[model samples]
Target: MQNLQGKSIAILATNGFEQSELEVPRDKLRGAGATVHVISLEPGRIKGWDKDDWGNPVDVDRTLDSVSADDYDAIVLPGGQINPDLLRVEQKALDFISKFWSDNKTVAAICHAPWLLVETGIAKGRKMTSYPSVKTDVINAGAHWQDSPVVTDQGLVTSRNPGDLDAFCEKIAEEIKEGRHERRAA
Candidate 1:
């Protein structure tokens, strides 16, 4: 695995996040020697959404109201239909995500999580991919939507679905190692 020792990663998610999407990357990053923290909108734990039912609960390490983008080297946004749908409407979440982009920190998203990217207004003129159902939404947000398993543009990394987790996690670690990236203006 890529060595990410000394790096700190923040995963932003809420209730309803896809179980695998959140857990896999968290485990992968931690295994790579990076410190990983799950930040949510509240204290305590957030429940995940499995295929047809609710999944396990993950403890929140920090709340949105108590943390800033400057606290971590990178951020990961995990997708579940309901997770992104709910987060997209949250101004605090959007602001926190926007700060990462503005600061040029690595921001990775997978599956439906790209919806947060859309709401942050950072999708314009970037190449990204998400769950098939989100293709049109991404395109409509001015992003160049593709059908790849994983796509990376600047410091932004995105993937289509849970099946793409391996590639997605790899790209995320690669991008984090590369460090901050200034995105080209649209």
Candidate 2:
């Protein structure tokens, strides 16, 4: 496994996040020596969406209002239609993401999570993947959409769905280790 002992990963989401998408990656990253911060639109706990119904609650470590991009090494956006949709509307969440790219930090978004990327207008000209239905919106936003389980572009890594968890988790940690690959002058 790649070393991430000193890295901090920020996961942005809200109520209705997919159970596995959020928990699985968080645990795996934590086990690999990264401090995973669960950031949400609010404090306390965020609800998990399991199958078609709601499930367990995960505590929120930081609110969108309090997250500082420079405090963390990378940002993760877990997917479920509801979570990403809600996050995209919060200017602070979107701005935090923009700062990730501006500083060449990694940003990983899976399943429906890329919706927030579309909201930031940076998906343009990049290659990525997501749940099939979101393909249209991604393309409309000017990205090259793929059918792969995971696709990483310009430090942004995206996965298709929960079925791709192994590939998803591996890539996330890799990107976290790949860490802050500096962008070239355009």
- Models 1 onward score TM values of 0.98, 0.95
| Angstrom error at residue 68, model 2 | 0.2
RMSD of each: 0.7, 1.4
Find the 10 residues in a row with the least total lDDT in model 2. 177-186
Tens digit of per-residue lDDT, candidate 1, span 32-138? 99999999999999999998899999999999999988989899999999999999999999999999999999999999999999999889999999999999999
Task: Write down the TM-score for model 2.
Answer: 0.95
Worst 10 residues of 1 by lDDT: 177-186
- List residue ranges in candidate 1 displaced over 4 A: none
Cα shift from native, residue 139, model 2 (Å): 0.5
